[model samples]
Target: MMDASVDFSKEMEALTKDLVGIRSVNGTAGEREVAEFILRWLRSFPYFTTHPERAFAQEIPGDGLGRENVFAYVHGTKEAGTGPRKTLVWHGHIDTVGTEDFGALEPWANDPDALLEKLLAEPDLPDAVREDLATGDWMPGRGACDMKSGDAVFLVLLTYLSEHTDAFSGTIVLSLNCVEENEHTGILHGLDVLDELKEREGLEYLFAINNDYICPLYDGDPHRYLYAGAVGKLLPCVYIHGCETHVGQCFEGFDASVAAAEVVRRINYNTALCDGYRGEYTLPPSVLKLADLKPAYNVQTAQEAWTYFNYFVHAASVADILAVLKGIVKDSMDEIAGRIDAEAEKYAKLAQQPVVPPNFQPEVMSYDELVAAVREKRAAAEAKETALDDELAAMAHKLRAKGRDLREISLAIVRELVRELHPTRPLAILFFAAPYCPANTLRQEVAGEKKLYDQLESLVSSFGEETGEQYKILQFFPSLSDSSYLKIDDTPESVATLYQNLPGGKTVSPVPTERIRSLSIPAVDFGCYGKDAHKWTERMYKPYTFGVLPKLILKAVAEFL
Candidate 1:
């Protein structure tokens, strides 16, 4: 049994401070150090030392910075005749955003006490924010709330389970991943490793509970949520090609940057594309990356420009998202064409020269169409070149093997194939980029879906009914999360078709559709409540996050497991 005399608050606070002090900033040198620290800490436990196979670390390499996903599990003692025990996965990310402009407080980065005092005493801090900090109810640090606090919560749960092995009927599996803020590579690697553990141990996962941080809905009152699904993310990059002209005759040619700007203005923060409403929640589209293609400083107008959007969706299909984006491009193009025609008329009237035919309305082409056109043109000249067909087939095969999206490879192939085939240099084209997370929702009318939903919902609602706590079933997590990999749909073939018909469909890869379909599992986000995550003043509300949330999660685990 767990030691009842132990002060849970102090223990959790110490663990959170230790984790936050490690400075496991993604893409930095400290990530490996933090992973090593976690491994060492896990090993220090007597249970882990006696059964070392129960806990270990798996290294996942990123762009330049490699990371590690730590895992620990405790199996149940129920008899073999009763069937296998269900697993409750507790997932948390260890990586945090970089610390920028820490100012004089940089010295206290490793000392939460000093940092907390500094933050509370800072003159520039807001009165409301400062008052909250002054109450000593918040732990202020870069990753303190965003969410090493959640990690500490899971650690405490694991520790308690180790002492009281019979407290639950099933197993408790914990996964601490990295790179969630940027690439989500950590979760990808963690899931694969988790599968290996499950197969090795002959365990069945009942649910994956991710402890990611959630922002409050109001200032004083924290609106607690139970996310039934994660929002899907898409990065759509558009390349605009324009005719370059000298500054003396700039009005005669279209500027690619201008077109790029118009596209940004049209799509950035446009709520029309946010049609993936489930219940009362929806995540609108926003801008993540935007840039214009310009070679060195010169007097000539730019010929090419590119921009990528941070498009998010839930419950919306690929075709719908594409159609909306295409409409935006068409509108921007028409407006730009009209503006250029009016400018040409003015220039012609002032200079007494014949009006330059305002024939610069660009045609928008999808990445697949562009690549196919290039391939057709190539095959016409050389009848024996079967490389393009082989390449596309190979891409599909690789996607099946890798379980990654096809956007990056497709973008590379399309850029290579179509760069030389652009007869119309001044046209706009849209392509998908790297990193695609498919959205998933639990709301379904199908019998199989409903059965699974009822099983989990019944378990969750029992706790509410017993405690008389009214819990709102949130539509979407409203953020990109690894839980997307856990969802499966009945119409998988249709889903695959939609994916293949997206803007860069030819290059898009299978999204673990097969795995999710075969082993579809329900996931929930029971993360800590916090304010200002990914910001300098990030902090977690101690009372609810540390005290109440764990008990609530424990209730679900007890009922389901």
Candidate 2:
């Protein structure tokens, strides 16, 4: 039970409002302020103050973006004399996406109350959404729903556990991490913290709980989900290198954007990729970001263009994802080749002139193959030289250490390599970007894995029986989460093969696959209820989010511990 003095609703509301107002948007001066505030808040508690070692902060060094991760824990009586005590981790990311114009309340950037008032008054706000706001039931801002609410919930629960340690019998870990909006580096920090904690206290991790926002089923539906796994995300960028032509002779050369657009047409919102598991879980590929890779306004038929997609996967591995992306590139390029050939035929007929033969077929090559070719060429050129430069070695060290700049450098190298190796052929290179988050689930193939999931189901069922409320075990979390960082058993050889096959593999973020797999802990995403996650209309339903969700968390902790 919670302390009678603590007003859970009011505290949550105040915390949520303050947190949402803080601009912890990814890539800017991100998460540092909010994380410092959390550390200070943790110290305010008598328990943490006395055991200050229990709370700590870590910096993810190579992030280059200056993001930090925070962690704290409340120890139960049993933890002091632990042989191997169970631990429950409450993890939440403190980062939000950009604060684009918040529609009518754009001016209320610093004032959350003004923003909430405007949200309540806006005529365009849907009735179902507005009605919920009227009943002490709204939080509006960038991070309000897409998870400051979850942070508030975790804080309250952690505080409660601290105040009433006798109610539970194991450690409750609080991880208020950064960079979930982008790289998911905070969870990596959490893994480090867990390792240290395990070494110090000899504790065993039981489950990780990520209280992300869970959107309602529909307008009026109040039911929420308890997700066992998260869908993986891979952003595969397709670079089209075309032959430039003067504007007057535009039909003489193909535009790179034409080929890029065709790729988008074949991929964007395509339902065939949305394969379902158990005929219920599905995540289709969507275009998160795309643009013509040109600078300034001079139009020379765009010699090069690129577009990346928000490709999602449920049961697929890196190899599976690469195969699908390769297939899409091939099919789109084939169609583009036919279109270009048709245009060439039409141009020849109209002008009765010698039309430039279109090299519509695009050459595709993996990053490894390109790198190997570049190495061979460089070796031959260097064979005549006797000495290596010290400056080049220093530059190599810098590049490896600060990998954030590798993508552009790799692209430049690939372009040069292509010019030297296959001067006449146009290239359409498909490759992954930074931050590869692989999908993970509690597989029941092993007896231990089966037991854990079965126990969770039984606990949820027990809670449902007590409250007469229905609960569901969601097969996959619809959104990407930090839980993807938790390691699983995957072959290093297989991961290496896939990595080598990726077109820009050398530039992609080096995901420590084996390290991640070694620390794989099962996780559950039981979060707040909201809608319009990344939009101006984003708001968390207060009644279910602030009220019932906390109780569910408390119940789960009690049962699991």
For each candidate, give its TM-score against the true structure: 0.89, 0.89
TM-score of 1: 0.89
lDDT of 1 by residue, 1-561 (tens): 334334467777888889988888887767777888888888788889998988888888423565678899886554242555688888888888877757677777556788988887788988878988888888788888878898898888787777667666678889888777776777766667767767777678876787788776666553566777677777777777777789898777788888888999988877766664535545566776566556478888877777787777666666666677877887887778778888888879998998875667677776666767877888777766677656656755565356554444554455555565765646777776656676776766657655656765675576567655445557568777777767644256546535544443433433556666555656778788788877677788887677767777766766666
The local lDDT score (0 to 100) that residue 386 gets in candidate 2 is 28
The Cα local distance difference test for each model comes to 0.72, 0.73
Candidate 2 per-residue C-alpha lDDT over 437-491 given as tens digits, one digit per residue, 9 for 90 to 100? 7777676676876787888788778777776657788767878888777744335
- Name the regions of candidate 2 deviating beyond 4 angstroms: 1-7, 62-66, 78-82, 109-112, 353-360, 375-410, 489-494, 501-508
Q: Report model 2's TM-score to 2 decimal places.
A: 0.89
Off by over 4 Å in 1: 1-7, 61-66, 78-81, 220-222, 383-386, 389-414, 446-470, 488-513
Clashes of each: 2, 3
